[model samples]
Target: MRIAVTGSSGLIGSALVRSLLRDRHEVVRLVRRPSRAEDEVEWDPKRQYVDAAGLAGCDAVVHLAGAGVGDHRWTEAYKKEIRDSRVLGTAAVAEAVASLGTPPRVLLCGSAIGYYGDTGERAIDESAPPGDGFLADVCQEWEAAAAPAVEAGIRTVHARTGLVVSQKGGAWGRLFPVFKLGLGGRLGSGRQYWSFISLADQVAALRHILVTEELTGPVNLTAPEPVTNREVTAVMGKVLHRPTLMTVPPPALRVALGEFAQDALSSQRVIPRKLLDSGFAFEHPTVEDAVRAALRP
Candidate 1:
């Protein structure tokens, strides 16, 4: 299979690219930067243009191009960046795909569990109604932005991901130093439910979607079990052989992350119903086991 992947340099994208390459599939990257050697293709998403001819023969396109959600402060300005990067980039990719004389069969675009917003202790799945808040709105629009491809008779799978965990980078890398120094603990009230997935499971789930013709629309790329903030802290503590003695309250996060603090503090109990029903196996189903596998340094 010849796969066209955007955001091929980021944490998840890079890993997925490697996995696809290992399977002897040709991987072409749709880069915002200049295309390098081989099957690389250049695209200017902000201007909303792509070389239709370049993407003509690809079997699938895994669209992961977007701004880092947790990278910038959630101010009005940064929020626009978040929205534009996803909505615009996704629209651009879909448009490009639509314009293709022979479009790809499958499109695995990135979405998030944030689409369910803060569900408190209530377990939400693909059947649940859309929730509120900034992240939720962004996620809603992000997935909606892929309508063109779906309308064009393509199998579009929205990978509604959760807190993607990896030891090499992402949310875990920032905590490694603190946990290694025995200073880690729960965030906010510590009871907020956290929906997370290890990098291995995330990539595998994506691969599963690429081949599964029956699956489409908001596939939760998360583990079977979702944990609380306290659970995550305990898991990390157990992995590092340290005691989670202190708790960082919500106010502290507010001070540290501004408006974005509420996002981390929000309780989102999301489940992988679609994936499970469709028979996607998770390598790390428990947060503790996933943490141990990731924190193996």
Candidate 2:
């Protein structure tokens, strides 16, 4: 199968590319800047224009291009960039893929568990309605922008991911040094629910969705048991053999992260109902196990 991957340079995208290559599938990248290169399609998401001819023979398209929700301070411009990156990038890819002579069998779209908003201690699943907020709104529109592809007879699947725990990128990488220094601690009101999954599990879930014909729409890419923030800190401290005696107060979080402080302090107990129902098995079912694997070099 020929797989066209967008955001091929990103954390999840890079891992997905490697996985697909290992499976010996022909992979094409949906790049922001296009040039005469092998298996690369240039499409400008900012301008919302993707050359249809560039994706003429695609068998599947996995869209992972987006601005990091927690990567920037919530300035007015940064907010717009976050919203536009996902909405526009997805729209362009959907349009291009929809125009293909042989459209891909599946359009694996990217979304986040933030779609359910901050659910507190409530257990949310794919059946739960969407939440309202910055990230939620962005994810809603991001998933909605691909309606054209779905309407055009292509199977569209939204992978609503939770906190993807990895050693090299995202949150884990940023916290490793602090943990090593014995400075790692829980955030404000560590009782807040945190839904997370291992990086290896993320890749496995993606492959599962790609192969499962019956799976489509919003699929929560979270672990079965959602742990609290305090539990997470305890497990990390245990695994790394460090003591988490300090705490990051809410005021400090608000000062350091601006509005995204809510993201860190909020809760979302998302479950992988669709994935498990679709026969997808998780390699690391708990945060401690995932962390141990991630910390292993």
Candidate 3:
């Protein structure tokens, strides 16, 4: 299959690209800079520009380009950046793909579990309605931006992802260092649920979606088992053989993370109902297994 992917340099995107290539699939990387290689396609999502010719004849497109939600403190400007990056980027890719004479069979647009807002103790699947908050609004718009592809009869799938657990990058990446140094602890009350997937499973599930014709609409990319923040901290401590006694108080989290602190403290017990129903299996089904897989050399 000829697969075109945006955000190819990002943690999840890079991992998915590597997995696709290893499986002998042709991969095209969408970049903001001038095309530097045969596989590179220039695109300017903010300006709603994409090189449609470069994407001609592509079999699939995985739009993963977006600003990192946890990369910076949530200033008003940064919040806008987060929303624009996802919405504008998705719209550009969707439009470009739809314009192709023979449009791709599948368009796997990126979504997030944040769409559910705070799930609290309630476990949710794709059947659940949208929740409230900043991320939820962004996700709603982000998914809606892919209307062009869906309207064109493309098999559009929204991979609503969760907190990806990896030692290499993402929120999990930052956690490994702090925990290794014995500075690891829970944030706020540590009672909030955290839905996480190992990097390996995240890539695998994405590949599964690319070919599963029956699967469309919003499908979560989280693991089957969701654990609380306290549970995750305990697993991290056990895996690292470090003490996890420290705790970041609510006031401290708000002071350091700004509005983003609410998201960090929010509980989301998300489940990958559609993925499993589609015959996908997880290599790391448990929190301990995921932690071990991520930390393994």
Q: For residue 275, give model 2's deviation from the true position in Å.
A: 0.3
Give the per-residue lDDT digits (tens) of candidate 3, residues 180-242. Answer: 998899998899999999999999999999989999999999999999999999999999999
Which candidate leads in TM-score?
Answer: 3
Note each model's CA RMSD in angstroms: 1.1, 1.0, 0.7
- lDDT of all predictions: 0.88, 0.88, 0.94
* Every model's TM-score: 0.97, 0.98, 0.99
* Candidate 1 residue pairs in backbone clash: none
Error of 1 at 83 (Å): 0.5
Q: What C-alpha lDDT, on a 0 to 100 scale, does residue 75 get in candidate 2?
A: 97
Q: Which stretches in model 2 have alpha-carbon errors above 4 Å?
A: none
- Each candidate: how many clashes? 0, 0, 0
- Candidate 2 per-residue C-alpha lDDT over 117-198 given as tens digits, one digit per residue, 9 for 90 to 100: 8899999789999898888888899999999899899999999998888878876667667777789899997999989899
How many clashes would you count in candidate 3?
Answer: 0
**CA deviation > 4 Å runs, candidate 1:** none
lDDT (Cα, tens digit) per residue for candidate 1, span 169-274: 7667677678878888889778999999998899999999999999988898888899998888888888889877877888888988898888888998889998
